[model samples]
Target: MRVWILSDLHVDASPWEPPPGERVDLAIVAGDVADGLTRRAIPWLAQHVRPRARHVVYVPGNHDFWGTRLPDELARGRDAAIAADITLLNAGQSRIVEGVRIVGATLWTDYSIGRPKWSQAWGMREAGDRLTGMRDHRRIQTRDRLGSPAPFRPFAALALHVEHRDRIERILSEPHGGPTVVVTHHAPHPRSLPAGEATGPGDAAYASDLSAIMEGEHGPDFWIHGHVHASRDYRVVRTRIIANPRGHDTSHQRRDGSWADERENPSFTPSLVLEI
Candidate 1:
């Protein structure tokens, strides 16, 4: 079971062409497949990888939620997943693929994760206005079709925690029958970040609880995530953490396809050719 893991494919810059001749059993896209409006990017990625891999699994990232309500975001994302003929794992969805129980979620960030320093990111903005750029403070809320008034902060650091707390808790508690795989858009654990990555305030917060879980006796056979654009693969207390990202245009991984020749940069896909 060789798997290709990619994350943060910020469309305009990132391009991925899997290595030819490699037998890919599964293709796992951690998150950030679109840039707010190009929702189709999700299904495009799925459709592209389907011919090569037996199964495709995906999770959603923050950018995927821009300008959309919680309900519509999930609905559209799930629909794209289905149309792409791929499995969509939102906050607490699980599926059995290739003999592994795959569990996935957005898991989100809570300001207290590691007491991150957001001193440089604070700001006061008007409601319903555009929240541009890539900062938590830049998240703006929009009206949902369900008429549920959205929170003032669209990307509030702890929003997902409050909304999907119970769902994630249940997922974390489920028993694994055999080799299991856990996937999330945010960093699963602090250590999951490579030496140079996972430095953002948001990353610090998102990695804490999940990182704590990786330290426990019961963890997944494989743990995967994106968010922190840098590509990193390491083994923690119990599981192997893989963060394979496509990153931006300047990213070394983007200069040349990582599939066939990763010699230019080993941080890209096929980070591991696990034959599980």
Candidate 2:
């Protein structure tokens, strides 16, 4: 299978569509499909990006579900996936293609990243009101709108990661003789975060726990993730860890001044493609 990987393509940058004449067997989008849960925009973007692949598999990023109820958000995602002919993975969902097994979930976190710190703090509360993308992203309930004016549970940010270990454990437990690919929106290996807070899922603690739990085996043949907005390829246990993210705007950026410019770079472009 000619699998291509990319993630953190925020749809609010502008409505994006797959150009004609592109081709691929599978396209893996780790997360952040939208700037916020635009609801309608998910289907629009999914349908546009779906045809480029024989199969499309995706998970929503933190940015995709900032202030929404998890269940309602997931239901909307399923609808959009159906419209786009894409597979939106939840816990225990598995798809086998050409003998390669693919399974994933929206694994929730428990602040188990290195040193365990809260994603939100006192400053963060007021910060959103000042900054456009940085803090507003946390409070955004949907595209063109903000989430509740009242504060949310601080743990909510890390809560989604809670169930991930179990789902991933199950996926790793499967005895597929052929190649197995694990996809996650959070960084699977800490090293994938080239530079950042160096504390959460993008750091060493989570990866260490992940590697230890799936004992007796080093790891899967292939693993891909996106969260910290870095392009990395290395080994953790026996797995080939790949983190290739076409991220949204932030303080740091690789190329291009805006998401529009980033979108113009085709999926097959060297910056976006991760063939396997």
Please give the RMSD to the true structure for each candidate, in Å.
5.4, 6.5
Error of 1 at 252 (Å): 12
Highest-lDDT candidate = 1
Candidate 2 lDDT (Cα, 0 to 1): 0.58
Q: lDDT tens string, model 2, 66-147?
A: 6575555677778767877787775537788667777666443343445445333422332233443243234443321254
Please list the residue runs of candidate 1 whose C-alpha ends up more than 4 Å from where it truly belongs after superposition: 14-16, 116-133, 136-146, 149-157, 162-166, 193-206, 251-266, 270-272
C-alpha displacement of 191 in model 2, angstroms? 0.2
TM-score of every candidate relative to the true structure: 0.76, 0.72
lDDT of 1 by residue, 1-276 (tens): 677777777664455555565547888888777655235556567656677768888877766666555556677777767777888787767888767877787766554434444422331122113544234334435444467765535245355655554565466577766677888887766665555444545344445446556666656778888887677678777778888776665434434656333332346654345556
The RMSD (Cα, Å) of candidate 2 is: 6.5
Task: Give the candidate number with the greatest TM-score.
Answer: 1
Q: What TM-score quantifies how close candidate 1 is to the native fold? A: 0.76
Worst 10 residues of 1 by lDDT: 119-128
